[model samples]
Each structure stands twice: as C-alpha cells, then as structure tokens.
Target chain A: MEKRITFKGVWLPLALIAPQIVITAVFFFYPAGQAIWQSLFIPDPFGLSMTYVGLGNFEFLLSDPFYRASFVTTAIFSTLVTVVSMGVALFLAVLADRLIKGSGTYRTLLIWPYAVAPAVAGVLWLFMFNTRVGVITWYLGQLGYDWNHVLNENEAMGLVVVASAWGRISYNFLFFLAGLQAIPRSVIEAAAIDGARFWTRFRTIVFPLLSPITFFLLVVNVVYAFFETFGVIHTITSGGPQQATTILVYKVYSDGFVGQDLGSSAAQSVILLALVALLTVIQFKFIERRVHY
Target chain B: MVEKRGAGLWLTHVGMIIGVAFIFFPIWLAFVASTVEQQAIVRPPMPLLPGDKLVENYTRALTSGVNAPVATMLFNSAIMATGIAVGKIIISLLSAFAIVYFRFPGRQIFFWLIFVTLMLPVEVRIVPTYEVAANFGMLNSYSGLILPLIASATATFLFRQFFMTVPSELAEAARVDGARPMRFFFDILLPMSRTNIAALFVILFIFGWNQYLWPLLITTDPSMNTIVMGIKQMFPSGDDTADWPVIMATSLLAMIPPVIVVISMQRLFVRGLVDSEK
Candidate 1:
C-alpha cells in the first residue's frame, strides 16, 4: 500500500537505499551471479584454467552415483529431522497448553535450547554418544547393543538427525503452543460436553485447527534441515561412516572447498538454489493463503 | 481444562516434567563435564554432580586452553554479533523507510531485488561468495565475519511491514508543522519503531552470534575465530585424546550470551521471530 502522504525528495531516498543496494549487489547478487556463471565451466586441475562445458557439470552431477545419493540422503535427513522434532514438539505443546499453572516455568526451561547453536547442540550430543566416554553409549553397551556411530552408517545418520532435531524442538514447540492456544477453548469444551474423550477431542477438534501452523512449521523445518544443519553434521559425524550422513549442503562444501571440484560444486549450488527458490515460493503462497483467511 | 482435574492433571505435569528433563539433560551433562577434571570425564559415565575442578577447568578454558583462548573467541564473537546486528538494523531501517515513504523510480525493482535474496541462502552460493570475500581481501577479518552476513532481507521486510502500518496522518501532521523529512523520520518514525528495532536486534544478535559456516570458511587464523566455530577447532586432530573438560567448559561459555539475551528479552525475541518470518 502506498502512503497517502509522502515527502517529495529523490536525493534522500537514494541516499537511504544506497547501503542496502550496494551490499546486496556486492555480497549477495554478485556471488549468486558468479555461482550461476561458474557452473557452466569446469576448471582444470593444478589450479590452472577453465573450459566451457555448458551442461557437462550438471550431467555429471546427475549421472554420478554419489551426487544422486546425497539427494536421497538430504530427503531422508530432512524428513527424519522434521518429523522427530515436530512430533516431540507437538506433544509438549499440547501438554503445556493443558496446564493451569507452571506452563510459564516449563516454557522458560524448554525454550532456552533455541538459543543454543546447532553446532553447539551437536557437540553436546556428540559428547553424550561419543564412543569411549559417552554416557548414553556406555548405557547402550550395558544393554548388549554396541553403539558406535563412528563406524556404523545408520548410527551415524541417526546421531546427526537427533543432534539437528534437538535444538529445533524449542522453535517448533513455541509455534505449536501458540497455535494450540489460539484454538477456541469453547470448541474443546463443547466436545467434552458431547462425551468426547481427550484423545478423540484432540484428533477431531484440535488437529485440524493446528494444520496451518503444522504446515508452516513443516516448511520451516525442512528448509532448516536443508541449510542450517551443516554444523550438526559437521561436528557430530563429519558426514562420515562412508558418506552416509552427507546432506546436499555438506556435499557442496566438501566438494568445492575440500575436493576442489568447482564445476560440480557450482552445479550443485545451482540445483540447491532452485530447491530453495521452490520452497520460498511455496512458503509465500502459504502465507498469502493464511493472510486471506 | 474442560473437566475437573484428577489423574489427568497429574499426568500432564508428569509429561511436562519429562519434556523439560529431556530438553535440559544434554546441557546439564555438558555442565557436569565442564566442572569435572579431565580424568573424571575420560572415564565412562562421569559424575553427575558439579565437581571441585570447576575453577580449574573454566580458568584453563578462558585463559590458555585449546586452539586459542576462549576469551579471545568471546571478544571476537561479541564484536561480530554487535557489528552485524547494528549494521543490518541501520541499512534495513533506512532502506525500508525509503521503500515505504518515497515514490521513486525503480522502487518496485529495488524491492524485488531484496526479495530475490530471500530465496538463496549463503550455503547455496558458498564457493562464489568465498571467492568474492577473498578478492576483496576480507578473509580473517571482522568485515569478513560481519559484512557478507548483514544483507538481511528479513530485517528489511520486517521494518517495511512495520512502516506500512504507521498512520499517514502522522506524516501529514508533521509536514503541516513544517517538519522536514529527516526530522519527521527521526522524531516520529524512529520513536514509533522503537519496539520493532529492539525486537529485531534481539533476533539478529542471536543470529550473528550463532554463525558457524561463514566464520569457518573465512577465518583461517585461530586468533580471529568466533566462539561457535572455535569449539570445533578445540578438538585435537589425529586422536591424541581431546580435553573433554576444557571443551565442555568452552561449550558452556559459548552459549551464555545468546541464552541470556533470549531469556531476558523473551517477549521481544518471540515477537521478532514471528514478525521476521512473516
């Protein structure tokens, strides 16, 4: 919406916007352009020269088994992280919403984890599940199950997923609690009067009401798992135990920085850019619908 | 809540207690490990209570432990976080004011340009961004840590959203009073936006403090490392037995500032999260 009254002056506005425009152009747009441009060319080894390969890098990425595997890994990782975190959060939010007292105390205790960095969260979890000194690993060993993420691929993936999901629970819990509280208590009370059990009332009257927030959190959690879980994977597993835990973002860093495969990494970056653009579109579309509602 | 409480209320409390315990367990374990001596932690299932070696472990970590002292990393982190939070707030506030308050050429284009940045995060364009930083000689510096991270479209949009809600009559009245644009902005709009600016500051401060990959890529020097990235470097390479007590102490130290901000400014933090995401 345009303001009905705006001051007349081009210079002030220009001066005001200059900083944002310059930073966006230099840091954001320029590098984005470079990523797109460099994706089309392959650099020869020995840090020498670039050859125009057009679609060769993309084709290589698509055909390569490992690149394809990372796509699958990313999907699996995001799904697992989203579901585990959101499920636990929903359970806690429902319990918190039902409380008459102590909810604020519970919330304060639960929400501090949101301030913990994903990388730091990973270290905490890593310490818990570390091979030798890990308390959880030691307990599991007493149960006759040898828990070693360092060597086992599934264990490695599990470790990273848990670590990533750990900090995320606080965020999802906050949103879910807000959503749950927004639901009319009268509706649930009416359901109770109609002889509905607590579980039945939640399933019939509450779950549908919470769907919008659920969908919103789903998108946010997936986007988070896609991009922000880099630290979790880096600290916990390093995408180890035979690349079993390497999500797409991790692969971009490893290939581009560590392996020096510029073309493939740039191609991967372009592909990821497309993925984020699609997700952002979906998110905005959802927001638009919510606004209309 | 609908029915009289009996077993259900007790059950609810139990469930919440369990949830809180689950959330707090990992941090508690880290705190426990941080207080103990190295030998106590190296053994399986370290002591649950706080140990006598708290002073020793924390002092070691803060003074002369690991890759670089934790104190230096904390100082670097504070600077980067403050720089990013202040820089983004200023640029975003000015640009958002310009976009909302001025009818200018290419206003729509500028908005879309900022909007497009919302799509691609730094992770997608890491290599090229790294090269850009290197070309600008920004690596291993505070500018490298803060500048590339400060073009936040979220903060800009949040300000723009806030500005659009401001009554036009306020501006009209100001203009009628012969107040210039800058004067009106400073006296009227700035006062009105105090809550939003404070809210965005809380969120942005946490974001800047928690940064990992950017600092990891840019800062090669240990002296320049932020606390979040510095912890990873504390782990001894090549299996010579990591100093668990010191590492845990550093981990606890890394979380203090952000956690304090969140707990103290919780209302603003929640408002910022909901608004910025919107």
Candidate 2:
C-alpha cells in the first residue's frame, strides 16, 4: 500500500498521528479492553469489589433462557429486515432501471428517506401503530382487527422489523440502482434478442451479474440490522412486550445499564464485538474480491 | 434504458409510482399529524391533508416541549453533529496523512491500530464507554457526545485509501520545491481533497446527527438532549397522552437538516457512500 516516494521524519509522523492514536486508545481500546476484562469478573452487590469468574459469565448467558431468546430474536429481526429492505430495493431499482426518463425524479423522491434516523423512523411507525391513537390502529379497528404493539409480541416484532427496514430501503435502493446501471446493456439486449422476456432476461442475465452487489448489500444490510437498528428497537418496542424485540445489542444495554449485571453485559458486549469483527472480516474479503473484479 | 415504450412501460411506471407513494405515505402522514391539532390526531382517522395548526404546533414544540424546548435540542444536535464531523475529518486527515505520506517507525502498527477499530461499534461498547465518559466528567457535555463516537476508524480508512491513490510524483515535486511536509499538506494536498472532504462531511454530519445510543446514555439532563433522541422524551411517561403534533413537529425538525444535505449534495453523498464502504 506504500507509495514509492514518501516524506521523511520519525517525530513528525508521530506528531501527525498523535490525535487519532490518543482518541483511539482512550475511547476505543480502553473501553473495549474494559469490556473484555469486566466480563471475566463478577462484581459484588456492594459495588466495591470484584471476583474473577473467568468464563462463568459466558456460560451463564449461554444457559439463560432469556438471553437465548434474544439470540433468536436478533436472528429473526436481522433476517427479516435484510430480506424486506433488499427485496423492496431490488424491485424498485429494477423498475427505475427500466425507465428511460424520470428515473432521476424517482431517485430523488426515493432516496431522501435515507436521511431519517432509525429512531425517528421508529417514531413514525409507532405513530401509525400506537394502540390508543394510531391511525392504522383505528383503521384496523373498523375491520374488527385489533392491533397493539405494546402488548403483543408478534405485533411488536413486526412493527420494529418494518420500521427498521423502511428507512433502509433508500440506502439499498441507491446501491441497487447503481449496481443495475453498471450491468452491461449489451448483455441484457442480447438476452432480449434471444427472445427472453423481461423476467427471463432478468433472471438469466441481470440477476446473476448483479449477485456481487447483492451479496455485498446482503452482508452490509445484516450488519446494519445488527448494530444500527438499536435506535429503532430502542424507540419503538424497547425490547419489550416481554422482551420479544430484545436483540443482542439491546440485551447488552439492558443487562449492563438497566439490569446492572455488569459481567453479563460485558460478556454480551464481547460476544457482539466478535460478531462485528467476523462480519467486518467478511465485508473486507468481499471488498477485496470486488477490487479484483 | 432499453428504449421500450408500451403497456409494459406504463406498468413499470405505475409500479414505480406505487413504490414511491408507499415510501412517502408515512412521512406524509407524519407531516399531516405535525400540522394538526392534538384532538384531530388523537381521534381515529386523522386527516390526510395538512392542517392550519402548523405554525402553532411548531412554535409550541420549539418553545416548550414536554421535557426541554425543541429549539434547545436542535441547537445541541447541530453542535454535536458539526463537532463530530469536523473533529473526525481533521484527525483522520492527519493520521491518514501520516500513514500514507510517511514511512516512519511504527507506521504499520499505527495503521493497523486505526484499522481494527472498524470491528467494534459504539452500540457494542455502550456500557463501558458510558462508564469511561462518566469518569472523565463528560456526561451531559458535547465532548461526551462527540468524542467517543468519532473514535471509529472509517474516516481515517477512507482518507488513507484516497491518499494511497494520489500520484506519488506530487509529493516528490513538492519536496523538490523545498516545501515542508505540513506546508505541502496545506497548500497542495488539502486542495486536492476538497471533494472527498465535502462528501465525507455530508455523510459524517448525518451519522453524527442521527446518533441515538450515545446521546441517550450521556445526556441525563433534558436540556442536554439532541433533537434525534429528544423526540422520544417528549412522550408522556405516565398515563398522560402524548402531544402528537409537537412530537411530530420535532421529528420533522430533527430530520430536515440531514435530509436537505442528502438531497442537495446527492452526487457527493452517493460518491462518499460507495467510497466509504469500500
């Protein structure tokens, strides 16, 4: 990665990098190291002493039914958010890509929602689904269907998933549209000349060619669903309705901050740290592959 | 793109319109709710069109929210967002400059050190990070909100990537002209990085503005709240019903800045989006 020519000086380079190194060491490494350290020690109720439990915290978390449920919840939430957002985005991108005019208008109209925070998105969805005053709840009531996210686990999960996925559509759409545009027009036209209809051409040629982007978006979306959706979950369900929406990140927060089970939360944090590290490695590998392409 | 014009084209347009409409409906409704009176929204079947109470609701939110004034929260959010965006850009620029422009002792180690921060997010390290912030007496301060969040390696990585691609001849030429390192960076390199910096600023501003967990943790005082996290606080805690119009107004206010940035500088936003992920 080095350039052939470079500037000289040991202290000068150190001086340049000093601020970032200090911030990284103080804020990034220190807390991360503390999380790992704290995970191995069980603090007393008195908050004055700590007893080292080695891997006991991890063992307990693995056995805990609620923590296990949260794992399942995280899996379900991440999968649903990823699938829904990407599916809708790919569909819209295909539609937009088919247009010879007004695509820019459509892109503008579609992409602004990317700026809406997940928490704000959650609020928007919650306003629609709130049990007492929600407009959707009222409409559903007319059809003799009851809706209350604060009470029902399925409804809560459904709301959070939709809220999380909604704003994500804009991001996924932009990428998909970019990806679709990059596909060779000649290849698709050739498929058309071979008498393939739109769907057939898309399936046989476009989708296969787009798989790299699809895979990239898939991994990226999962990472988003895992980490960034904290706002959505926090604002809407708050891992509530009997913890139906408590994903791993939320569990870590609730355990440490709310529940004050420091060791358990730290253990969960370490686990999440590992999860992020693994996903990041996968993303880097994919990026390297794309560079080769 | 294929230049097809037929019923299929019409259908495609209709499908695209529906998708766009579906995307806009929630935001439209939220906007409508923000403009309407509380009773109008609290009642079933809120009006689809905007109401005349827009100014009233917005002013109410700005002046006296349930927790803190919306104006205060907005100001706090702006400061934190700008602080984060500017702070990260400056430090990352320096570090990336050091790593790419110099081959000093521990260069590789510093590069890897910054690089590995990508593996952990603020959300993962929430509790301990909060503890660290609290210990530093940064609680309820802008520094607490911005500093910990900016420690991520992305901007550094992005800048490093961009620096690597710059022609090495420029540096050699600068040296031949007797320009020192800092002088070269300021007079030459900084000018070259204008687009990248602008793009990164847009994205990072949004990232910082939209932050939820860190602000939620650090800002115990309602006055310290950023608008993004402040909206939730406006909801009544007990049996008291929410003031929907004000809350909705605050939501709109919170989103407007970043949305404007994204829409106005869209080309740069897209470029930054693609480049940063890589």
Which candidate has the highest DockQ of all? 2
Q: Give the least accurate 10-residue stretch of model 1 chain A, judged by summed lDDT.
A: A1-10
Residue pairs whose backbone atoms clash in candidate 2:
none
TM-score of each: 0.99, 0.99
Query: What is the CAPRI rating of model 1's predicted complex?
Result: high
lDDT at residue B32 of model 2 (Cα atoms): 96
Expressed as tens digits, the lDDT of each residue in A1-293 for candidate 1 is: 67778988888998999999999999998988888998999998976889999999999999999999999999999999999999999999999999878898898888888999999999999999999999999999999999999999999999999989989999999999989988998899989989999999999989999999999999999999999999999999888878999999999999999999998899999999999999999999999999999
Per-residue lDDT for B77-143 in model 2, tens only? 9999999999999999999999989889888888899999984779999988999999999999999
Residue A211 alpha-carbon offset, candidate 1, angstroms: 1.1
Instruction: Chain A only: list TM-scores of all candidates.
Output: 0.99, 0.99
Candidate 1, residue B231: lDDT: 97
How well docked is model 1, in DockQ terms?
A: 0.82
